[model samples]
Each structure stands twice: as C-alpha cells, then as structure tokens.
Target: MSAVQTQPGGGETRYRIAVDTGGTFTDVVVGSSTGDMAVGKALTTYDRVFTGFEGAVRRAAQSVGWDGDEVLRNADVIVYGTTHATNAVLTGRVAKTALLVTDGFADTLLLREGGRRDAFDSKAAYPPPYIPRQLTFEITERLSAEGEVLTPLDEEQVRSVLRTFPDHGIEAIAVACLWSIINDVHESRIAELIEEVLPGVPYTLSNDANPTIREYRRASAASIDASLKPLMADHLGKLRGDLLQFGFDGDLLVVTSEGAVLDVVDVLDRPVLLLNSGPSMAPLVGAAAAPERETVVVCDMGGTTYDVSLVEKGVVRHTREAWLGEPFVGHLTGLSSVAVTSIGAGGGSIAWIDAGGLLRVGPQSARSTPGPAAYGLGGEEPTVTDACVVLGYLDAQGFEGGFTLDHDAAVKAIETRIAKPLGMDVLVAAQAILDVSGHQMATATRQAALEHGVDPRGALIVAGGGAGAMVAAIIGNILEADTVLIPATAGVLAAYGAHRAPIATEFLSPLHNDTRNFDSASAASAVKELGKKAKFFAARFETVNPDAQFSYFVDARYPGQAWDLRVYLDGAPDATGDAARQIEDAFHAEHDRRNGTHDPASRVEIITWGVRVEIPRHELLSDEVTVTGESVVHRHDPIVFGGESHVTPRYRGVTLSPGQHIAGPAIIDQPTTTIVIPPEWDADLDDRSNIYLNRKEA
Candidate 1:
C-alpha cells in the first residue's frame, strides 16, 4: 500500500506519477495540475518490487500532504522505468531458455562476431555466450543471403527437437534463422510450431524482435527478450495488480532505452526495450532542467553504478548498438536506443587495496540490503560512503528518509579494510578514495563527451542520482565545463524525467543501397511501410495525447565501412532523385562533423531507415522560490578537502531561496543528498530551485 495521510481538499485533482526502480533505490514522483511535484525514495526490495514501489509512492504522498491512495486514485498517467531487465541479464536470474538457430550456425552466439577490444592480447579470457552450447538446438532450414528459399524447413526434425523441451526443462525459446531479417518465412513457421508444441511457454523470433542486419546482435536481442519474457511479465503483472488495487485506473506506461514511454501491452511482448531505461531518463531530465543550455552531460551516480549520457543541442544521442554488460566483450542489442555508458563507481562501491598495492573502487557494490558500512546494516566492507563519512563529507544525521549514518562503523570499516592495508591513516585513506573515485568519474565523463563529438569546455553537466551532487562539481571542474546544474530532485531525477517524458515508439526498416545508384522507388516503399507501423503504434496513445509528432533518420556511411553514423532526414522518403541527394548531403555533413573529414566523391550507403513517433507530455512550470531569506550557515564542520582538514560551512537546502549565493568551502544538505562546493567555486539557486555551480575564476 501507499503512504497514509489525509488532505483538506477532496476536489477533482489530476495527477501524474512516475516510478523508477533502480538497483539500490525505488524513486517516485507525484505531479499535480498545479505544477507541483513531490519526490519519494525507498530502498529497493528485490524479493517483491511492488513493496518498495508502494513505499516510495507513499513517501512522495506524505511529502505533499495528500493521502497516497488519493494520489493514485486521481492519477491520469503513470510512467515506470526500471533496471530489472539489466540486472536480470547481469545476475543470470532470467528464465532457462533454449536457442534454436539454423542448422549450420548453431555457434553464432558463441562466435560473437569474433571482435575484441584487445586484439593482440591472446591471454585475455574469452567471455561466454548468454546461452550455453548445451542448450542450442539446430533447425534444418536453409535460406540464401538474398532471402531465396534454398531448402524447405524439415517439419519432422523440428517436432523431434521441440519435443525434448520438457525433458530439458526449458522455460522459453528463441528462434533465430539465417536471413530471417530479409524474409522471415522460415522463422515464422518455426514460431508457429513452437506454440503448437509448447502451449504456455513464450518464444521470440529474431525478425520480430530485432530486424537488424547482423546475425549475432539480432540473436542476442531475441535471446534476451525471450529470457526476460517470464520474469518481466510476472513483475509487471504484480505491479499492475498492486496499482489497480490501490485505486489507480489510468494509463500505465513503461519507459524504453530510447528514452520514450510506451503502453504496458505494447512493451510486454518485447521487454528488451526496457533495458537501460533508468539511465536514459537522466539525459531527458538534464535537457528539461537546463532548457537554455545547448549541450549537457547527465551523470547518474547511484549506489551500484555511475551511468553517463550526453544531450547535445537539446537532443539525446542515439545508438544503433548497445551492449548490456560491457561493450565489445558482452552481449550487444541491435535495437536503436539512447547511448549510455556505465562504470562501477558509486556510493556503495567498495574501496580496497589491490594485489598490486593500488587502491581501487568497485565493479562490485554492497547494494541496499547491507548498503555502506556507514548504514550499520551489518556491512563490513569499506565503501565510498564510508570514506565520505570518515572524511566528514556525509553528515551522521542528515541522511535521507531520516536514516542515520553510523560514523564509528564507517571509520572502523575504512581503517581495517582500506587504511591499514594501504599503510595510511583513516582520514588520508578516505581522501585518497575520494580522489581516485573523482578521477574515475571524470574520465568516464570525458570519454562520453568525446565519443558523442561534444566538447566538455562549454557543455553543462547535470549532476543526478544520490551521490551525483557530492562529486559533480569536482568532475565538472576536472573537465573545465561551463557550469554544473544540480536539480533539487537530484537524488530522484530519473523519476522526474520519466514524469515529463513523452510517449514514443520507434520503427526500423533495413536498406542496403549506395546513394549514387539509390533505388528511389524501393526506398520510398520501405519508408512508407515504416510509417504505417509508426502510425499504428501512435494510435495506442491517442486517448492520452491526441497529437503525436513524427521524425525520421537514416543510418549512412561510406561504402566498405564497418559502421555508419545516423543522419536525420528532412521528412519521409520520396521517389525522387533530389530526395536521395539530400540524404547523401546530410551524410557528408555528419561524417565531417564526427570524423573531421567529408567524402563527397565517395558513394554513401544507407543501411537502416527509422521512424519515431512521440507524444509530448504536459509541461509543468516550476514554482518560483520567493521566500526572501539570507544564506545562513547552519554550522561549521571539519571536512577534509584538497588533502587538508578545514572547517566547512554547511547549510540546509530548504533555507536557501532563489538568488541566495554561497561561496565554497561549503556544503548544502538536502534531505536526499548533499552538495559539496569546493574552494574557488560559487553556488546560486535559480528560480526553479536548481543549484548552478560555477568556478569563481571562470
């Protein structure tokens, strides 16, 4: 159930709610017609996600002086984002699935494109496939690369192989045949047979799930979706039931990695779309929080991982291929999505001395149950939060949800686990941890900006997540960014982004044509087909948003190139030479911008054509903070900064009004998070209650 509270007015109130279930926390945002938003946060309960979901909603309701039940009863729209799919794949908690491939390519998933980051390092261990070799079953089907049926599918052999599903105890099945994307006749037939043999078991076909060119990537997407079918179906079913029982009867939508929201019914079939959905929302929040900035880097530092994404010219960057665990080493999903990079650096990331005698912070986290040593929840390992406590960056009594930090436990954990091994005092070890963690985050931020063709010098960095603001200014300063924008809801900013994110769906069609000899008729036909699909998807949202906006993009590259850069199309493709020329010109411009060279004389090849439809969410104007109050320091605490202990001024966020200025060697404590402004930096609150931090020298 939701939090219990009573409000005075019982009039008709329209509500908008968004919930983000993360690895460490479940965040909620309740928005009203009055442009007011209340945020709630609770530790994630892995056993039953709805327990934490309801608790978070209740927390938000309590903050707004409204009964949680009332808010749910009146909500018009509810958007949800989660890290469950990603976690399932990473932790191997997915259903036991079988991979059915064409006869000769049973090792397709094993080969994995034969690409590696360290090409010469033969000693590096090769990673295993998502599905093991023992579980792969081959189908006697043959189709040429040009989609010609070379041999008919063997019906008797298919029945024999599928009949073993019960003995193998397969919960789901994935069908990926050769040349399926070009013509899915054989794959479709196999799917029909699967349903006949296994009535209740779910199966996914490669062409239906991801219609990309590559075989391995397409198979990976299909396998992932098939694996998550049972898990996500159950998870979403319980969530839907809980919300309905709480009196909510509105439209329920789930956010996708592409940063778009889709209906529950539309996404339940292909749950892979929800992978990385939580991190994708950070960029949207950055764009909305910094409307005036042309570019912003959104960094989400949670308890388990730090996810970074770029927003350039107010548009979130899109990627054709996204890896779930690690790029070039992990499984790649060929579906188009918002590009995000994650590193194992967060508040609960453990700090320990490596065998090489170097201090390291995590790819492993304590998560929420044991949390940090500072939580006094039976965790013994020293984490970043413990280091912060030992260094006095985190207050013992200022934690969110009225939780208290165990200072003595934090110090002891740091001393025994890190300081003693490193041959340094606890304070010095904590400072070193902070410095090392800061460098890791800054390095990631720099790489994200560079890969996206954005310069960090003038780009704004929006600090989000619980540990985001604490180290945001430091990371931005290292990159020499223009400024750092920390929203008041920094801890729950992903939920805030989902609260205002648009309803969107993308449709993709493959094309392999050189621009010089482009088949305009064929291209026009393909674009028209994609448009039909887009329209059908948009119709599902008509009840909530009457008008939906549509956009188009084409992936193009110079002939013989391994990868292509996406260029926005002016509109739908046309059966004219001029339209092809326009697309070629756009390719040249993008190539020049990204590679510093343009090949106008070279033939441009278009690989994939895409159509995206988005129905914009209702814009909520932020309430102006007009409580004229001076910035007063609550107290002075000895905090380690720049390797030295200095008395730092601490102020509560609630007492700071718009236009109030504070110079660093200071800290601003919000209920959910803390902002540390280092020396030579100054901070000011804007009308929207966003903290803008700038270097005094700049």
Candidate 2:
C-alpha cells in the first residue's frame, strides 16, 4: 500500500489535524512543532457531519493565520473520529438489512442467547432486533462444528433468495451459516452469488468478518457489519472526497474501537470496529498523556453518556468474546478503555417524573436538536441541564459564550414537569436530580472497578467533560480513590485524544487448542503472518521502520470452562511456557478476586491468538517540569444553587502554571469546560497543566 505524503514548502508548515464529531459540537485541533496549537469548535451538523468538520478545520487554521487549504496541503495525517455509527444504532437510522442464516436459525437474532436486555432488572424488556424476523431468511446448508461438510449448500435456494432481495428493497445482505468460522466456503459462495445479482449492493459473510466460534454471534456480528456497510461507506467516501477538494492530499485515518487508527478505505469493510470509536479515544489519549502511571481510571462524560475505562500498565483492557447481538463471537478484539461498563448519564440526559411520580434521569437524551431545556432550543421538558440551571450550578447568562440560556423556561419546565409531580419545591427537586445523577455515576464507577478486579482505592480517576466537575467529587468519594485529575481541555478531551492517537492496525486469528500440547513454532509462525498483515495495513500511513514493535496475545480458557483469558507475550520462544504460566496465574488471581476462590487444578487451553502493530506519531514536549508562577487570589462571586447562594472564586485553566496549588470551594473556567472544586477538596497543577484534586484530609 502506497501512502501520500506532503512536504512543507510555499509558505506552508507540516501539520497534523484531528477532527472529532460529537453529538453537540465538532472540534478540530491542529498541532505543529512551531509550539503552536489551534483549536476550533462548531455546532455539529447531524444531517452531514463533514460540513461541520470542514468548517472547524478551516476555523482552526484561520485562528493560526494560515489558510485551511494550505494547512491541509502540508498536513501529514488527518484523523477523524465521529459518532455517526453509534448515533445510527441508537437512533435506529440504519439501512433495511436482511440476514441469511442456516436453516432452523431464523430466530437466532431475536433470541439473543436468552439474556434479558437489562440483566439487573427482572421486568425489563428486550431491545428490539435491528433486523426483523420477516427479513431473516434461511438457507439449506449444514457444516459440522469441526469444519466437516455435512450437506452440500443449496445453491439454487440461495439464488432464489438473492432474486427476492431486490424486490424486498434490501440495502445489504449478511450471509451466515453453521460452523462458518472453520469453513466459510458456503458463505463466500453465497456472497458471490448476491454480489453477481445485486451488483453494487453490499454483502458480508460471517467467517470473513469475525471467524470466531459460536454460530449466532458470528452471524449477528456479520449482519451488523453488512447492515452498516452502505452507510459507513457513503459517509467515508463523502468525507474523503470533501477533504481532497479542500486540498488535503495526506492519508486519511479513522479511529477504531481498539484505540488505533485504520485507513478509511479499510474501515468500509469492517465498520463494526467503529462502533465505540468516539468514546474509546479519550482513554487512549489519557494513557499517552500520563505514560508513567501504571493504573488510571478515565471517566469521559459527554452529552449522552459517561464512559469509564481502566488502563493498566499503559494499555487498555480488551475482551475476547464480547456480545455483538449475544451468541458469543470468539473474536478477541480491542475495546474502549473502561472495558467493564458505560452508563447513560450525562449533561443532556433527560430528567422527568416517571409514571410512579419518581424522578428518573435518562436512558433518554435531548441530544443536539432540542438539547436540554437550559439550551433555550425549544425543549419544553425538564432535563438534567435544566436541573443544573434551576439549581444555579451553571451560569445561565454565560452559557456557551453567552449563547443565551432561558433560565425562566428551565425553572418553569422543572416546576411543572418534575417538581409538581414529585411534590417538591423546584430548587429541592433540582438538587435531588443532581444527587441522583451523581449517585448513578458513582455506582457505575464502583461496579466497573470491582468487576475488573481493580482496587478502586489505588486507581487515580481522570475526569473530563462539562458534567465531570459536578459529579467527580461524589464518584471519587464512592470509589474511595484519593486523587482525581481534570484536564484543562476537559470538554474537548476526546478531540485531543483523536489528535494524539497513533496510526496503527490490529490482526487476529483463532487458535483453539490445548496449550500444553500446542506447537510453539506454529504459533510463532502465525504471529509472523499476522504481523505481515498489520505491516501491510500500516504501510498506508508511513514507512515501516525496522524498530517498529509488535505486541502479541493468546486467548486461553481452562478446559471445560466457557470463558477465556487473554495473555500477552513478548514474542520470544523460550518464554512461551513462562508466558503460559503467567497467564494461568493471572487467571487464578482474577477468578479468586471475583469469586473469592479459584480452582488451581483446572487445565488451561489456548483459544485464540492476536497481534497489534502500532506506529507512534511525532513526540511532543512533556508538561512535567514545574514552572514558577505567582498565586493570585481572585474575589468570589455568589453562585445560587439548591435554594441557597455560595461565594465561589473563579480561575482560568490556561493561566494555571505547574505546581500552582489552590484550595477547594473554587471554580476553574476554561473556554471548553468548567471545573468546580467542592469544599474539603484541594487541587494541584501537574506538569501537563492537569488539575489533581484530593480530599483535604488525604
């Protein structure tokens, strides 16, 4: 794969551009070695994200006194991380897709492995299937679990189904069959037939897409990939064409769920990798920013949800058998930093009185359209943002650079919609809403830390976003984590993550077998093969340096156990056995930590193998060394909240020098976000200008 590179000349300087398209805003950050950083934010265009993205890019370039087209012409890499895929799934705006599965498995997508939609709630209903049963067609083909052919594929029946797809107005086709992971000949043939008949229509096959064990999961994963293919392809194509028109000749990369970047063209074939791309970038950026930290907890509170990820030993945790639609696709893959969980709790989450007259915060969101009631965007209902406004925690007059917030509407909405039904005063109701939302976030943080076998007390929580400051203290108290750090660019942290993200790719293959009897030489050969694949992908971004490193892992399971454990290896032959032992020990430690005991006598087996190749970007100066600065005491202003007023002093994020410390009961304001340090907490500025908050006693 050849890469397009641009050299600085003609009054141009080399630049790296990162564009993050969020629910409410699109942020563009341009970084150059000239010790200059330009940041731009614009209202996101939901109907066409590229319009906002390009606008932000141009604005960012203009801020630095450079033409956007000239900057694009001199840029080395342009990385994009968007919320399109996630929004599509959440809003149910996907294409009309049909699933072609093995006979007798038409209900596989609907069954969802017999797991309830909400595992904790007994009365919760299952989420509706993305593809309806009427669109799920069955084909006559059978293959044994061991890759043995049981019955020949019914080619005539497949052709007949293909003929009806066009008549049914199907946009995409997913071909999945039993045991296709081991033998995908039938599925491939089906895909070929569909393509021949449908021509331009997109088609996906299970074995080619995931190639992991478990029939239903593989099928569902492939179905999701196929379903999103047309949409993703169209979006990427438009973005690429638009950038090219804007004079960007550099290679275009998109962030993946694994915290690495892949070429936009490659992403079209594996759109599933982009499922959690936007939310996953923050942890990666945080980890890179603080490489020395062995363990850190990242809490990214966006408009719609709060995503928490745990980073241990400078790497994000991954899952081997994550549920796509729930049958269990055995593909070991990279996921978001907080692999344990994410919850629907954020600034724009809706707050309303339930049928039982109990106040409930979202699962439902105001999103970008009407937004929160405080946004003054025709939102008549009270929301979390409205609660913040009514409580006076937010400065309604200065919201979004004096974009104008309707405080009266916010209060009135809360009074009639939430306060009246709950039989409480508006101020008290607002406080209750804030407390509940904070409690929900705190509980989620505790659960994630505990489930990951991590001690919450030992982890440093890094909080970012507009809502993070409001909830950080509560979450920190509940998790028992003594230190919490908030970045200066908290609101645009994801965008920064996109800026600092590396251009890399991952390759995986299953190797289910007994580890004790496994051929280490064959495993090494497989690793080499995957490395070649990764190198092939990485070539599109930069020349592969001989010093480029490769990380390997083997997914193992105890014999007779359904779940597997991932064990990282350093790519040495003599250490293979020791690696296996270390993996077993880690598994025992994890199991003991989770279940209070471990069966040491259980035999372990290796299920899959994977390799990730990373190509780092140009290094920037570290924000570690302390700089001398004077501590200026600013006068306090009264902030009315919870039916009372408190004097809160404000500081600027950019003006805070390293080592400058401040006591709590203060507000630190930045253009992107505001951090409220509650009483009993103290904050210290770190090398990177990140504010670390700790309890006074601690």
Please report the candidate that would top TM-score against the real structure: 1
Model 1, 463-496: lDDT tens digits are: 9898999988878878887578898789887888
Clashing pairs in 1: 3-58
lDDT of each: 0.84, 0.72
Clashing pairs in 2: 309-337, 309-338, 623-687
Deviating ranges (above 4 Å) for candidate 2: 1-11, 58-74, 116-130, 289-294, 320-340, 390-392, 395-402, 420-426, 478-480, 519-525, 544-546, 572-602, 620-635, 640-644
Candidate 1 wrongly placed segments (more than 4 Å): 1-10, 120-126, 620-623, 626-632
Q: What is the lDDT of residue 578 in candidate 1?
A: 78
Q: Show the lowest summed lDDT stretch of 10 residues, model 1.
A: 2-11
Q: Could you give candidate 2's per-residue lDDT for residues 150-203 as a string of tens digits? A: 989999998888889878999988887988767778888887788777888888
